[model samples]
Target: MNTPELGWFKSSYSSAQGDDCVEVAVTEQSVHVRDSKDVTRRPFTMDLNGWAQFVTSLGSN
Candidate 1:
């Protein structure tokens, strides 16, 4: 994926000190996720429906 063109943003739950930072970018068809601390790492992508289910599951915990 062309990550540089995506508007990536850090998770709201990210620490101020930059530890455990996760960044995400959303597009029409997929959701991109990556470690904010290491941009060189390849991000994982999931379909929008799958992403929605994953987020919903998080809220249940």
Candidate 2:
């Protein structure tokens, strides 16, 4: 299946210098994650539940 085009946004925590930048796009079924500095690479896809868990886990660190 073709991935849907989404409006990706850079994380607010990303550096102003543009290094280690992370971008995310939300869709109906999943969230797409990619490196802002390397858009040519395939993105990592996660379901809503997985995405929630991942974000929650990050908050605990």
Candidate 3:
């Protein structure tokens, strides 16, 4: 994906200390996730439905 044009943002829950930082970019069709500390690494992508399922599962746990 052409990441440069994406509006990547860190979670509001992330700490100012910068540890465990994750960045996410949402598009109409997919959601992009990556480590904020290492933008050079490839990001993980999932369809919007899958992303919603993942978030829902997190709440269940």
Candidate 4:
């Protein structure tokens, strides 16, 4: 996928030191995720519904 075209952004909680940075970009049907430090790697993609469910699950932990 053309990750750069998607305008990925890191979490607001991300620090300037750049550790543990998770970058994400929202598209109409899917959400793209990648490690900010090694963006050249292929990203993980999930459907919107799955992304929502995953986020909800994280909140429960």
Backbone clashes per model, in order?
0, 0, 0, 0
User: Candidate 3: which stretches are off by over 4 Å?
Assistant: 17-19
Please report, as a residue range, the 10-residue window in candidate 2 with the lowest summed lDDT.
1-10
Query: lDDT for every model?
Result: 0.88, 0.84, 0.89, 0.89
lDDT tens string, model 3, 1-61? 3487888888889998876899999999999999877788889999999999999999999
Candidate 1: which pairs clash?
Answer: none
Could you give candidate 1's per-residue lDDT for residues 1-61 as a string of tens digits? 3479898988677778876788899999999999876888889999999999999999999
What TM-score does structure 1 among the candidates reach? 0.82
Model 4 CA lDDT for position 16: 84
Predicted candidate 2 versus true structure: per-residue lDDT over 1-61, tens digit per residue: 2234778888788778877888889989999988877788889999999999998999999
Candidate 4 Cα deviation (angstroms), residue 24: 0.3
Q: Give candidate 4 regions above 4 Å deviation.
A: none
Off by over 4 Å in 2: 1-4, 17-19
**What's the CA RMSD for each of the models?**
1.8, 2.9, 1.7, 1.5
Please report how far candidate 1 places residue 39 from its true position, in Å.
0.7
Tell me model 3's lDDT, rounded to 2 decimals: 0.89
Residue 13, candidate 4: Cα error in Å is 0.9
